[model samples]
Target: MLFDLHEAAANRVSTTQRRNTTTGASAASAMASSLTASRANGLGGLDTAFTSTEDLNCKENLEQDLGDDNSNDLLLSCPHFRNEIGGEYERNVSFSRASAGSPGGSECRLAEPALSTYRTNASISVLEVPKEQQRTQSRPRQYSIEHVDLGARYYQDYFVGKEHASYFGVDEKLGPVAVSIKREKLEDHKDHGPQYQYRIIFRTHELITLRGSILEDATPTAMKHGTGRGLPLKDALEYVIPELNIHCLRLALNTPKVTEQLLKLDEQGLSRKHKVGILYCRAGQSSEEEMYNNEEAGPAFEEFLSLLGEKVCLRGFTKYAAQLDVKTDSTGTHSLYTTYQDYEIMFHVSTLLPYTPNNRQQLLRKRHIGNDIVTIIFQEPGALPFTPKNIRSHFQHVFIIVRAHNPCTDNVCYRQLLSGQTLPCPHCVPEHVPSHCSSHWRNDLLMWLLPH
Candidate 1:
């Protein structure tokens, strides 16, 4: 969206200038000369001038109407247009003509034959007819590319599903981040039949690449590094990493329908009974606000948690992550603690504050959304050992919650730290606390930084 149309225009003009300088005459002149010569003779000879005014007018009109056709012809003729094999022009022509059917077969024959007869028999001066057609033909075919739309494919499938968005803690000054997917290994599967690997590329920190392999694991194994991470036997890998999770998050957000669907799912409610918890900054927040269920909209999310206590499964609980109160830029607020449970599996949702009352209610529709507690059971059949590291790794499967204030607060904070700054959110900084400068800080100091 930031691309400049003017710059694109300038680039096209400059490219044209370069081509003209290298090839001697501009494309317009070459086309004009070819057309003029074709008209004067029988389109096969050097010059024998057509004298009839009607013939001249028809020739000029044909040239004007075939403006892009003339450019195409000229480009085909140019030696520079030839590919390494020297057959590109012919191939292109073949491709073009294959798609271009005759207007109406025999009934819609071109007027070339009648014009030819008029030229051969009449004696009216060529200059007597209008010069408008010739002048117009001599001008550029500036709007030609619109005839065959390119890059329209990228915008086509965008209307289908929910869009999932993930924020990579990035600096605003680094420009917009671009994402792309790369697939590696085309070979057939060896022991397990066949397998493929995909790497998602993001333009963060100049270039940060994450690769993930889909083997027998329900969750794919991820490698958070460059493509240099070599592939090995699927069994040899211990656990799948979280890199692929981020890739999935970003890609989902890119699709509008996907995002809508994910949000809709939260509103519709999941099949499983919901358990809830609420974690919010209490700095600027007043105690008058008690976590409650909306009577009009069924029981409150917190009530569901107490109702489903042991009936569900609290497989494990994690200390609520604590951080300085970001909204007030103060250290008075308590950090939120989160508990992990398994009604079915472990599901994590880290989100920004929901804005409107409706939006907040929609978020509260799910137990995990209300109480930051995840309760999705691992779907794999076999029971296995679970550790802190495994839980952390699986936590990468996160769904986004909209931030009420800043959508990119976390990303902004991450970039500031990467750039050697450890300040709190700028908007929330209070007047009383001493300004925490970026420099002259101990590396070991645990500075409370905020993510938007």
Candidate 2:
């Protein structure tokens, strides 16, 4: 199962992660070499060379109640999209055809145990643009690598696209907020002795940490987590914010059908098994070679907002899954987390939807799954697919189809990049697409979505 240098580079894992420390800097160097070679051969998707064009046209203060949260202003608009936030739509929903020939298809294992308190999606709306890039022409994409005096490095990749997925946790003070991965930096923190902070940096540049007692390996023997007061981070943010950044709302207006579906998903209610959308972690590097070798170095791209895709096997798409234990209560609270690699990848329920391709053939081409390029499916929990299924399909049936990406909102981030507002990866977008998806896309996904 040999992969191309470009594809492999497009999905590179973190070389500096402490877990990889055993392999040391040499392995990192090898990865760099591979990335360099791949870039030379041409392959920088979202990670390398990708930048947001919206930054140039957008204004500075997007959260100042300019006009309306759903404002249709060119520069300032609502960013709230209509994905999986609707109520449960199990009303006779079933797949048109059974998994008669679906290769990766399997029985439905997801079942709702109880929901004393749960969140379909966050309802908050706050996004702002950066001032520096407003005055100048678009600049080259780059990363912020800060070197502290403590012989440690804190690097944040800035050149990524639409934050399709997000991490969430509860704050002792602010209740709950979005979280960003701190990576394996146990020794870097001087005050806290080897602890990871699930923190969210708002558009206001406020770093809020969702406080909770940390547990290791999330073992069966670990102490139970305490249920705190008020709404969980996701709900709290949703409660405070009334609308999406106006930018997203305007984009949704243009795509009424998808917007309608998003509203439907939301009304139906969102769950791990029946999510309306899926997130991808784009993997690549920002290098001149990457820029030169790749034609998609520009910002129009939005797919795979890089993180750790290798860590995502086929959870919703296949029998292989990552366990996400959920516990909710009537006190407007819920807790969800997944234990992986001797650590828990915690999460708060939210909403998402991705139309990676307008048509099936295009999807195959983008993933390089054609004749010479065979996309091998591994049952391993961490070996996820390039394009994953949004919801868990049951043995009897499943419903819903892919929603086309909204061009108006695809490349643009909710706010400014510096404000921690990331854009969605908009790759595989048709240069001159029709007003909506073509007939082939809707006729039936069985041809492409299901295995032969």
Candidate 3:
């Protein structure tokens, strides 16, 4: 069987060689005939005739090879032939077979003449795209504002109104305080999902005379004060100026004209006050002694008091202390007086006031806070909700509800407790208002409340 197979293969090889010789001779004759026809016509006709003859030769050769199934296998097996014409031969065969199978065989053959010529010179004939086309194709995408739903609510309706008043610290004395809280979608905070941007506008009437005086006195004092509080003199000035401005603005807002306008602005809300009053109320503690002596409530209450008007290292050091007439009590029994940002804040503690006989409501403590425009209600964790309706005070327009956070669980709560007890500032620092809405509120007040 091996001897017979060898003999058949040798015969096939001889037949293929003979056919190749004949095909070469026929191709030469066809080329000569085409050249003769082109000369009789024109130069253009010469190109057309040459292309047509070459295509015809390639097609005939491809068809002949295809008819003999063993031709490709034999050529590929021979290393010399495969290296010389394997790629070109395969491409031409594929083109020929595709044209023959397709319905538009004649059109394809005419359209795609001189395939080898095109393939060889493709690198030199690269088509360039026009600059205009490139500009149109690579243009930046237009983002439409109309398609974006911001879903922003009105300032009063969203913040100061009854809806989210619990989460915010609204001071009626500051006039119209607008908190423009914007949220942007963020991928980093997948759990939280959005980053909040707070832009707070304190629309208090400008006190040019008071501001000028405060700046003149405080500027020199602040420069001399140095960076004792870990803040630069410039930063300290920035902090002091805004606070003093707020203080003066609060006083200016109390003028008959501004007070009437404020009343008209929010009639249904609590009446305006000159000073921000804070009242500490604890559940199940009626007497001053009982409230201060309690384990859980006492510590939290003292912490809150210390936060408001904690004693500074340099007593009466700032010019604001003299300007605001802030007299630190030696006894520390009176309403704790502390100057924050040059503004004097007097915290009216419920326990410190005289407990009236058979009066659990404590009208004495109420007298001080009820008259104030903006009142902060500091309640223990399990304390009853101290509503504005219960106070029955017309002057207290805004109620800021503050609850003691669990020091073991809440990070801010723990930090605040530590800072209050250990870290005493040279200047009276403003108490940080804790918000349940967003964590951004913790430090944002210092940044956003800067005077423009």
Clash count per candidate: 38, 50, 2
Model 1: residues >4 Å from true position, as ranges? Answer: 1-151, 158-194, 197-452
TM-score of each: 0.15, 0.15, 0.28
Better of 1 and 3 by lDDT: 3
Residues 1-452 of candidate 3 have per-residue lDDT tens digits of 00122233344455554553322112323333444554565655555545565555544443222111112211111100111111111122122334422132221122223334222211111123323433332211221011111111123322332221111122333322321221122233556433322112122221101111122223334343221232332333334334322322212322445434433443322211124455655764323233323323367767656645553322344432211223443212344445433234444445554456666465555565556545555566666533232344435444344566662234424111101111111111223323332323332222111111
Candidate 3 clashing pairs?
270-397, 273-373
Model 1: per-residue Cα lDDT over 367-420, one tens digit each: 233233222211011112111111111111211111121112331110011110
- Report every candidate's CA lDDT: 0.25, 0.22, 0.33
Please give the TM-score that candidate 3 achieves against the real structure.
0.28
lDDT of 2 by residue, 396-445 (tens): 01111122233234332211000001111111112122223233332222
Ten contiguous residues with the weakest lDDT in model 2: 146-155
In model 2, how large is the Cα lDDT of residue 22? Answer: 13
Model 1 lDDT at residue 284: 28
Worst 10 residues of 3 by lDDT: 73-82
